[model samples]
Structures are given as C-alpha cells and as structure tokens.
Target: MDTQHDNALTHALAAIPGPVPPSGVLHVVIPHTSRFTVVGNHLAQHAELSLIAIGIAVYIQSLPTGTEVGIKALTARFPEGEVKIARALRELEAHGYLRRTRVRLTKGRVATRTVFCNQPGAVLRGAVVGAVPVVGPAVRSTTPAPTLVREHIHVPEPEPVAVPTAVPEEPRPVPEPVPVREAAHPPVRLPLRTAPTQPRRPLPHPRALTPELRQAASALLADLRRHAEELVLSEEAVEELVPGVAAWLERDATTDAIRRALTADLPKPLKHPARLLRHRLTALLPPPLPGIHDLAQPRRTPVTPFQTCDGCERAFRSHDPGHCRDCRAQYWEAA
Candidate 1:
C-alpha cells in the first residue's frame, strides 16, 4: 500500500537466498505461487530486519565516499516508516558501520548520508587486502610453513686413502663485424582523379502573336459568349492568349488577378444572358465586312390584333367580336 512497504516486500523477496533450506522451500514456493501473502509474512517476520540493517549499512558505507540518498528514496526503500528506518540507520552509524558526512536538502526535504568509517582501517590491517589499492599486487597471504620431523636409528664404518694436487689451462677471445645496405631509390605515390565540370544550358526566346491569329481568336471568343452566361476560363488558357482582353479590362499585370467566375444552374431565360449581351454589342461594333451588321438584319411588320377577349376570358380572332358567347348570355339576362 505504501512505497516503503512495497519496496520492503520486493527487497525481502529479492534477498531470499537463491538456494532455500529444504524445509522452507515448499513454504516459500507456495507463498511465491499464491497471492504473495505467505511471502509478505515471511518478509515481515524475518527478511525485513536483516535487509534494514543492510540498507542502513550500505547507505552509511556510501556516505564517506561522498554518496548520498534522498529522504524520500530512503523512505521508499524502508518497509517501515521513517521512525524505524531512522532508528536502524542510527544504530548502524553508532556501530561504526558508517561515518557521517553531512546532512543536506534533496527535493525540498532533508536526508542523512554517510560512508564506511572502517574501510581504510580494514584495508590497512590487511584483513581486507584487496580493499587497499597499493597492496593489491603483493598481498598474497603466506601459507603456514610445514614442520620437519626426525627419527633416530643408524650406524656405519670407513676405509683410508691418499689425496693429490694438480695443474691449470687457458682462456679465449672473440670478434664481430658486419654492415647492412639500402636500395637505390624510394617509391613514388600516384595522384587521385577528380570529376569534370559540365556545360551550361541556354534559355528560350519568347514567342510573338500574329495580327490575323489575334483577330480570329477574338471572334471565336465572341462566338463562345453567345452560348455561355459565365466565362469560366482556366488560368492556363488566359495566360496562353487572352493578354489583349486582360489589358482592355485595365487589370494591373501583377496585382489585379482575373480568375474566371463559375455559375450555378440557371433558368432558361437567364441561361444565355451573356449571349444576348454579346450579340447586342457585336451588332453595335463595326464588322470586317462592310455594313455586315445592317445587311444581316431581316425585315418585320408590326401587328395589331387580339387573339383572346379580355372581358369574357375567351378566344377571339378580331377586335370587333370582343364579347364572347358567355358574355352575350349574361347581357340578355340583365336586359
């Protein structure tokens, strides 16, 4: 439930010897397999006390070496609360397991850290030979010397002889001589190859439009206006050839962008409004053929006749027969 408590459980379980006692194996295994309750109890009763000592000792041993532990982290590892943890730590310190360095703030809280005070002494006394650096190579311990034993029981006799003196010989000397040679010349190194530069490309010339082509294009556009109510031209199409039209509209070349507007479905009368306007304007303009606008016109006569009578709401071919049959009957009734 608590961080320290949980850490304690974890630490105790971790500390349990890998090779368990035969008697406790089954119990430990059952607890390990079950919901960890048996493990928790074992930790509470046994493993925890030893581990607390270890934690405090380890913390203290680290302190003199300039190591530190936060109060929060310490509490988290201590299964018991700060009181018990502090007590155990103090006990370890008193027992010379540690040498206090200093207290300091960590994460807005205070904590005590220490180092192993007896480490140097242990190293000096050769009890922990490897603990000291200088004596590492020559610290091989002397094995106990074997004892010699003697047994009594022996006897023997001897014979006599004469001795003689004699002569000596000579010594010799040695000599050395040899020289080495080098080749006639040194070797030369080859150079590396570099990539070559490529030639540059030329730009294209602008095209010029012919007068005849321009006129033909204009006429074609006027014809299109006869059928289209809105001119929804593509940007590519305008950029390709409508320079004259755009110039006529006085749109600035850079800023006044002319985008073709689109139209939704229109009623029959409005569908060809642009066409009607184009026809009227075209007729007013001079044609390439002389008097072509006037010559194209057809003659017409004005009419003055009523095809239906307004008063009777009936059909009549002449104005004189204004009253229909239904009106005549109503007139007779009134008389």
Candidate 2:
C-alpha cells in the first residue's frame, strides 16, 4: 500500500460515523457503519477497526513484508478462507475496485492474478448508463447518439379529380300461375299415441353348457358318483362339483372350452379332497391355460325365519338350526 493512500484511508475512517481520538487516546468511540466502508478503509483508533478489517490486518501481518500480493492470495491468507472472499471480490469487481487478469512472468510463463484499484472513467460510464437511478433523472444516456432535426414542406393545389356515375338495373318479367286440384277423399284421423307392445321376457331355460364341457362334466360326475360315499356328496354337492370338474378337465388339452365353461360360474369353492385333486391337475397343465376353479362365490345371507321363541318370550328372525340359540344352549346344558 502507498503511504499517501494509507493516510487518505485513515482520514476517511475518521470521517465515518464514529469518534476518532489522537494516536495515544485511551478510549475511542465506535459507530455502526456498513461492512464495506470498514473493510475498505484503514483506522487510526482501535474502535475504528471492523472485525473484518482486524481479520484482514492479522492475515496481512502474518505474511512477509514487501511480498507481491494478488487478491486470491490475500483472501486465502486466513486459515478459515472460503469461496465467499471470491464472491466479495466479485462484488468489488462490480464496483470497479477489483479485477482479474493474466500477466507474463520474466521466466516466459503466464500467471493469473487479481488486482484492486479505483474504477476507471470508462467503467464508471458503463455502470452509470446501465443503472436507472432512483432519485432525479439519470445522469447518462443508454446509448451514444448525435442530435438530429426534421423538416416539414408545403405545396400548391393542382387539378381536380373526375368522378364516374353508376348504371341503372333492368326490369324483370312476370310468370304464369298453375291450376290447383281438390282431394277426392276426406282426411282420416288417427289416435295421438299408439300403445307400445311389451317386449317378451327371456324364457327360463336349462343352463347352457358347451358340448365338450358337458361331456367332460359328465365324465367327472360319473367318477364322483362312483366315489360319492367316500366323498360324502349330495345333490347340491353334485351340482357344485360339476363346474369345478369341468374347469379342471379342460385345464390342459381343452383350456379354451374350460374357460368358456367356468367364466360364468367363477367363485364356487371345491371340497377339501377335490381341491387337492384340482391342485394336482393344475400342476400337470401347460402354461397360459385358464385359471383353476374360482370357488369364491358371491356371499348371500341365508334367509332368516321370523319366529316367536317360547323359552325367551321374544320374537326373533334367525337362520339358526331348528331351536333358537339360547334354547339350544340350555337344552345341551340340561342334557
């Protein structure tokens, strides 16, 4: 730093919103000032120094005297240095106080470095022209331009323009009228709305089963009937077992027929032993065949009979076995 510049910095620091005493003064009054002013200027008193200035001073004091310094090198002098210094330097650059450039060394090598100084006139002009001032009109123009003038001219009247007239339309000829004839018979009257014929409801019919599925189901029924006693199947069981058996039989060589057969009867559960047989049959089938019997039938609540219970002296609706639940329990206890 130049001695005269240092002296000027000390003077500016004194002018800051704080009290400045002589060099040997015991106490100095410090005032709140923006960080930029504190860091950029030097101080005469201890209170005049900002925390950042103190930190920078300590960093500079640590380096050897007369050492050539660059902005990055100066910023990195502290152990806790970070990219923030580069950012602050950028702000300083925007203010025209800092700059970066490459310089050729005496050893035929180039070195990149940052320099700090007051902004030049051209840079200041660019900034002032760029910024739209808040107070008063801006001092600079947006672009360079020369003053210009425009002129108007007067002329004498000349010849008048001619106007053309439109032609008239021609008259149209009249047409001859045709003769009319009367109707032979009087018009007939019909009722406003005719009654709609009711559509015939579909007739109640036996379940539709494909020929191949029916044959397979028949074969399964024959097998089940042969072993009915062992399986404990009744009439209801026969009805339920047929669809599942059809699906299982069609699972391999006749999957398409089985799919057609089982799609509507999906969700009817098989008995335990029959379910095991179905599983074995599924394992023997090829890939992409129709799924096994979906024994999951839509749940229906059993109809509850409305009855008066003699034991409980209450009317209740129930799907329970012959005796009401309470009576059944009491009878079992007495037994």
CA-lDDT, candidates in order:
0.40, 0.44
| Residue 250, model 1, lDDT | 28
Measure candidate 1: CA RMSD: 36.3
Kindly give the stretch of ten consecutive residues in candidate 2 with the minimal lDDT sum: 147-156
Indicate the TM-score of model 1.
Answer: 0.20
Give candidate 2's whole-model lDDT: 0.44
Q: List the residue pairs that clash in candidate 1.
A: 61-116, 63-114, 63-115, 64-114, 64-115
For model 1, how does the per-residue alpha-carbon lDDT over 3-108 read when each residue is reduced to its tens digit? 9998977777677766756575332232343222111232234322456755554443323223344445568865678765766655444443334555668687
Off by over 4 Å in 2: 1-72, 118-335
All candidates: CA RMSD (Å): 36.3, 43.2
**In candidate 2, what are the lDDT values of residues 164-222, reduced to their tens digit?**
77686685554322222311222223345768987633221123456777666656554
